[model samples]
Target: MNEMLLAAFALFVAYLYLPTAWLSGLRPAKPMTRQANHLHCPENKFYIPEDAVLRRHFVSQLRWEIEAALHPRPTDSILQRHYDALVTIKLEQRLADMGCLKPC
Candidate 1:
């Protein structure tokens, strides 16, 4: 049947690919490359301060937490996150002051 043939072909392909350990030993060792730890959070798109630069802020960390608690989805870019955080902080301060000021 077609199903049986397809299943057998898949198994054959998997068996051929799985034992790449033997092939690795036959090739030259890779040249030294930057270790994962040295690089900034390249893979973690959500990581704050994704790259190093002048005036780079790791503020995304705090912003993300606040956004997660207060808003959904969060901002994508560092600048957007920074702006959102600033707006949230300022609004909170204003609200706090307004609360303390008895009926105007």
Candidate 2:
């Protein structure tokens, strides 16, 4: 029957979309905390592409670019920049903890 088909389609759509919607807003809604400030990436005063972890050109800039893309927020540039910096810092810390980061 038409009703049965419509119900089945609705259930299929829910099954596919619900998980994505649930996971989309995983970031905290509140403003950044003091602890979060500590997690931000330090300013790069001196950078050398050859000494980078992957030896890629403009490695730090590339990282920031990727982080900015992956964790985009509907916020001002300053807040978004800070969020990306924190993401990079956390990524570096995780790599260091795992012993996967070679000294550069």
Highest TM-score: which candidate? Answer: 2
On residues 1-104, what C-alpha lDDT tens digit does candidate 1 reach at each position?
A: 99999999998998788778977887898775544444443432332223565114434444455555653544569867776767679555544543422211
Provide the clashing-pair count of each candidate structure.
0, 0
> Which runs of model 2 end up more than 4 angstroms from their true locations?
1-53, 57-70, 73-75
TM-score of 2: 0.29
After best superposition, candidate 1 residue 54: deviation in angstroms? 43
Q: List the residue pairs that clash in candidate 1.
A: none
Could you tell me the C-alpha RMSD of candidate 1 in Å?
15.5
Every candidate's lDDT: 0.55, 0.59
Best by lDDT: 2
With candidate 1 superimposed using the best TM-score fit, by how many Å does residue 66's alpha carbon deviate from the native?
A: 18
lDDT of 2 at 14: 78
TM-score on alpha carbons, each prediction: 0.24, 0.29
